[model samples]
Target: MTRPIFAATPVNTPVHGLSAFGDLKYPAGFKQFDYANPDAPKGGIIRLQPGDWLFNQNTNTFNTLNTFVRTGSAPPRMELCFDSLMSGSLDEPDTIYGLVAETVTISEDRNSFTFRLRPEARFHDGSRITAEDVAFSYDLLKRDGHPTFQLILAEMAAAEALSDGEFRLTFSGQQSERTILAASTFPILSKKELATKKFDSGHLQPFLGSGPYRVGRFSAGRFIEYERVEDDWARNLPFRNGLYLFDIIRIDSFSDRNAAFEAFKKGETEWRGEFTASVWATEYDFPAVLDGRVIKREFPEDQRPSFYCKAINQRRERFRDLRVRQAIARCFDFEWINRNIFYGLYRRNQSPFESSPYKAEGLPGPEELAILEPLRGKIPEEAFGEAVVQPTTDGTGNDRRNLREAARLMHEAGWTLKDGFLHNEKGERFTVEYLVNDETFLRISPGFIRNLRSIGIDATIRQVDPSQYQLRLIDFEFDMIDVAFSLGATPTRDTLMQFFHSSTANLPGSNNYVGMADEAVDQLVDIAARADNRQDFTIAMKCLDRVLRARLDWIPNWGSANRRVAFWDKFGFREPKPDYGFPVEALWWYDEEKAKAIGK
Candidate 1:
């Protein structure tokens, strides 16, 4: 038989790190990660708004401190309060170094892993973090945690605490080779703290933590602060040196994006990641930016595949037809919006896997064709030809050529203009309501809505509060919604399954926003996940991208390659950030001399 793809140590040997490709960057007993500065100072506050978030996190406002469940909205960066079995490296793609567990040993069959915990590991309450806590955390998450966690841990068969300092996890044979990599990064909660409380309840009280920071003070929907732990247990660990340097990390919440921008302009918040192109180009002329007190610059985005688009709910019967979806996509004029609204700072997005090698390009190569040949009868014929691209429209507000084509396609789909509105043969009007949480979409979506009206479709925008908007999204209550997401540097099978698999199409709170349920796409995802090497993985993913683009369920939008940010000049950081992620609050520290120079 062929050797397993993940080649670990022999049954008795333990290693300091684990990688997907059986290679580790840092050797045993390494001093620190290459991206970390060993002498970075560790004090001062950094005030900012949330730039990115994970499961159950809402950037606008929060009602609960428990972010790991699906019952309520929570603030970002709550992950700082918990420790995991292993932590990931910033510069590498799929390697993880030990954090709470000192070393790990793999079984010969590759179905079991044993992690030995450090003897000195302790929780914030001065209690020892034992193997039992790790076991309890996994079992609880697999049963009562968020839906995302349930989907990821579906293949885990058992979690056993071999001893007070040793833990073992066994997986079913059906799991992918990289499932352990995702499992190792889950936060280990305290069994003693959560055993008496409800795991799924929405509560403002924080859990006991062992990571670098703890929840300090917070209101229900306004602001929350994380105070750095002075006696952090893993402060000097090889994987954690020169990180979490801020004495206090504060995150404020505002219902409106423009209000948050104003806060940054007045120096109430120290850092602001500018997302609106019009504001970035014209509104930086404030006195602070005119002087040297505030620095406005662009930082390179993370090197990963991202999806930014409008997802039409295929669960609704009106959007189930491919021709209708294609016609709706043709109505969007990215060229006009880019020039007139975005100030020519964005590029038209063409593929779901944007900025990655997995995106299907010209015609399918020999390797990709080998994967697509068997699925020919199931997928679209266009998927076998040159990759599908979005239509290029004239910069004129009304592109007669594309608009005429859109009208023809809608007519062919059994939707004809009658009494100034497109109606199907069954007398149902073609209406699309764009659901949003704030007034931000009012400025950018008018052109698209106007184009839709010109084609005799009833297009409208509906604005709701942040909480209600989130509730509607969870219930799949909207006709169309805009979603932007960044996948992991090396996405595994389980990660993609949550976004495209049929099993999660109707699952509540799942990320399959378009309600995709394609058998050929599911087969391609499985083949890609089972790849033993990077070359084979790339081929399978390119084939899958071709099929997804041909379906036209998600209409491509615009994207930028860099992050537009403005910050006060009181922080010091090393240049040339890491490739995979940019956690500014953890990497940058206060410069006292610069703060004095700025009269702060």
Candidate 2:
């Protein structure tokens, strides 16, 4: 007896006024200003100013948002200019508090979830947020949003309004706890306002958002200006209040990071994420830091994800053999790369879920063995029964010992050394082409290539422009490539499945560039997805991690211990959180008096 919930009449809520759903309450320690507080100043603009251009045309839809050329930078910038229904802790996993939603409840069976709308929540145009808007937002994103959006919600059968201010969304399968958290990404949009404007390629002009900031003006290629949304409904939400203290947020787009750094120094921008060692050690001897107009600080990041070595065309003919893949992993000189190019600013990743609760470390404990024993003959014995050895750095620059091991493994895989070249039984030399996007990788990858060459294997490095690199990646037209996969705040087996499963590999723009297809891994991911509770989910995820690590499907790279960033001292930040990245936009604010003292 499942039925789609629906509202019979269009609720004629005033567009420029607020309506009540129920009693409005703010989170603890949240003090609502009377819209007259001098400290909470009314009008000014804040500039985010990113070192990248907006590449995609569709900013209103999620489906094409990932395809946007500014994929690396836009999301962080847009985060300041939008609102999500739910907000997670700046500290721990599974610590989500309500934002746009007043209360979120999951049904006993876990197939359906209901979100009660906040009473006073309103869009930028001042239309009341009702259940209809939430349902419309879900429908639009599910129907026309990016493929990833659709794939993420593949199990969601329908969404409907259950009451005046409550909406229910039902999934086709047993809902994992992660599903509710994932809903936070689906920003709620106002349907009435959207219907008035012509959505060009799904891009909305004068982007109406219900967040702390509202888009004010845009100079196109130069900068997009945003002013604080005074009396913002979700500001007092537990995750936000006392956050976004700036009066304005301006996003200045630039083509180059170096130029952006120079702009920050010249007082054009306020912050920059330091990626180069030269700047890390040398930059910021300015009058700003001495006068407390700017502060230079380094905060350690826990659970920082890895920048991994992704295999392209995994289902393709050449990389089908797990032995060949393992040999390729053994060929890399991780020790050299960590010491030299990265300035030892990274740690080698041991598992896809490294640093998370799901990472399987040490020998299998009895409880873990119980889970493994049941799948004894179904999965590889090395996957369940063996201990994962810690990686070592051979004193020699080439990591000669590891190279020798790689050569031996390749040889055992029917590859033979002939005329100082390793060749398969058919006499084809074991040649691999490595594609990279940056100059740093061009310098770093050669060390590994040299190791391969020393072992009588041929490996070449191909450097391409960023655009060309992305094109090649989407086409799966490379042998080996450097890529990083991002997992959700709460790690799950779905993270592994999305990156290695056979089904995703066949789909375009999916993370499964590895084309991993084993019956056991597939079963583990399915079991993990259907897990009833947190404890069961963790057990399932750890089991999947053990299996994936043993297979060595991806050669792990190093993760940064801290987010290396440089910003004008006029802003302040809280202590770093565990699961979240630098919540810069959430925690940081402009020291207006200090900013005025160093007037532009």
Clashes per candidate, residues 3 or more apart or on different chains: 0, 14
Model 2 over residues 1-600: C-alpha lDDT tens digits?
A: 321111111122211111011112333344531211224433333444442222232111122222222222122255455565666554444345556776666555546667777778887777788888888778876666544555566667888978768788788864333565565456676778667854333342554678787766665445666667777876655444566676767656554455666677776777666655545656667676666665576666556334355564566665666677777777776677666666666677777765567777667777677777888887667766654543666734577678778888888778899999888777788788888766656656677788778887788898775546655665567787765554654553335456756556765555666667777777778776656455666777778778887776677766655666666655544443334555455456555675566663
Candidate 1 wrongly placed segments (more than 4 Å): 1-3, 8-12
Residue-wise C-alpha lDDT for candidate 1, range 348-466, written one tens digit per residue: 88888887778899999888888899998999999999999999989887898888888998999899899999999989999999998879899888988998899999999989999
> Which candidate gets the maximum lDDT versus the true structure?
1
Candidate 1 residue 316 Cα shift, in angstroms, is 0.7
Task: Please report how far candidate 2 places residue 507 from its true position, in Å.
Answer: 2.7
Task: Please give the lDDT score at residue 506 for candidate 2.
Answer: 63
The lDDT per prediction is 0.88, 0.60
In order of appearance, the predictions have TM-scores of 0.98, 0.80
Candidate 2 residue-wise lDDT at 306: 40
Candidate 2 accuracy as lDDT? 0.60
